[model samples]
Target: MNKKTFLGIAALLAVMVILSAYGHKLERGSDNVISLHKLHTLAQKGEQLTWSDFENYPFEDIGSGLYIRKYEVEGGSHLLLSGGNINLAPMSINLVKTSGERIDIRYEEIRG
Candidate 1:
C-alpha cells in the first residue's frame, strides 16, 4: 500500500459519502414548500395565520413566539423584522433564503 493508493481510496470514499447523502435527501422528497415573504406579509396583516393556510407545509409552534415551518422544496426569499415597538424601537430586518426545508419565524407579540 503506497501513499498514492491511500489517497485514491480516500477520494473514492469521499465521493461515495457525498452521493449517499444526496440520495437520502432526494428520497425525503419535497411536497410542502412555503414562501417566507408571503408569511411575513400575512403576519403583518395581524391575521393569525395557521398551517392550513399554507399549501402543503405544516408549522409547529415551538414556544416563546417562535414557529417552525417545514417545506419540501427550497429557493425562496423573505424579510423578517423584529422590534420592541412598532413605531419607535430597535428593529432589525433580515433578508433570508429558503435554502432548506426547515424555516423558523418569530412573532414576539403574537402568542397563544
Candidate 2:
C-alpha cells in the first residue's frame, strides 16, 4: 500500500482501539457477570442490591439469622431492599416491573 494509505489505516486502528477500551468499561461488571452501567442504573433507581461494579464479586446471602442487608450496602455492596417483613416464615422478595425503567421490590422473611 502507499505511504498515505498506511498512515490512514494506522489512525483508524488507533481510534478503534480507544473506542474498544471505553466500550469495555461500559460492559464491565463485577465478576464479569453484571454491567457497570446496569449497576449505576440500579443505584439511581434506589434499588438496594449488592453492587460489585469495579471488581467481579458475588452477592453474599447474609442468612436470615441476622437482619444484615442494611449493612451490606454500607460495606460497598449494593443492597436492594423492598417492601417485605422480617417477622414471617419463609421470607422472600419478589421484584415487579411496574413500567419501563421502574421496578417494585417486595421483601418477606420468616421471623420467630
Candidate 3:
C-alpha cells in the first residue's frame, strides 16, 4: 500500500482508540463521587456522611461504635470534603476540568 493509505489507516485507528478510552472513563467515573441530591436523600434517610451531617456516625471507628466520621474526594482542581475536627482518613481532592465546572465529593465509610 502507499504511504498515504497507511497514514490514513493509522489516523483512523488512533481516533478509535481514543474514543474507546474516553468511553471507559465515562463509565467508570471517579472513586466515590455520588450526586449531591442523592447524598442529601441518603442523609434524610438517616445516613450520616462527612460533608453535611456531623451529628451522627454512620460507620464504625476502628471497631468502635462509630464507623465513619470524615471523608474526602479528590478530582483535578475541585476539593470537596469535610475539613473539621472529625476525620476518617487524610486525602487530597483534585477537581477535573470540563466545559463547565463539575463538582464531585468523596467519602470513606467503615463497613463490617
Candidate 4:
C-alpha cells in the first residue's frame, strides 16, 4: 500500500480505539436498580448483604436503616414487596421513588 493509504488506515484505527474507550466509560457510569423484595428476603434468611451485592447499583445509607440507590436511567422505577408486613418485619422497608439522582427507601422495625 502507499504511504498515504497506510496513514489513513492508522488514523481510522486510532479513532475507533478512542471511541470504544469512551463508550465503555459511559456504560460504567450509568445508574442501576435493585430488587427490594430480594434484598428483604436475603436479610430475613440470615444472609449477610452489603452494598456490593447490588452489582452496579451503589447505595448510600441515609440514616434509620434507610437506603438510597441512585440510577441515571429514566422512568419505570419501582419497588416490589412480598409476604409479611414490611413495616414490622425484619429488613422491612418502603421503597419510594423520587425525581433525580437517587431512589429513597425507608426501613424501620415495627413490633406487633
Query: For this target, which candidate reaches the highest lDDT against the unseen true structure?
Result: 1
Among all windows of 10 consecutive residues in model 4, the one with the lowest summed lDDT is: 103-112
The weakest ten consecutive residues by lDDT in model 1 span 103-112
Over 4 Å off, model 3: 29-112
In model 2, how large is the Cα lDDT of residue 108?
30
TM-score rank, highest first?
Answer: 1, 3, 4, 2
Summarize candidate 3's per-residue lDDT along 26-55 as a digit string, tens digits.
775553444344444443432233433422
Q: Which candidate is the best by TM-score?
A: 1
Native-vs-model 2 lDDT?
Answer: 0.39
Model 4 TM-score, 2 decimals: 0.30
Q: Each candidate's lDDT (Cα)? A: 0.45, 0.39, 0.39, 0.44
In every candidate, how many clashes are there? 2, 16, 15, 0
Candidate 4 error regions (>4 Å):
31-112
- TM-scores of all predicted structures: 0.33, 0.29, 0.31, 0.30
lDDT of 2 by residue, 1-112 (tens): 9999999999999999999977775664334333334444543433233322213433345656543232122223343332234343222222212222222222232111
Instruction: Output the TM-score of candidate 2.
Output: 0.29
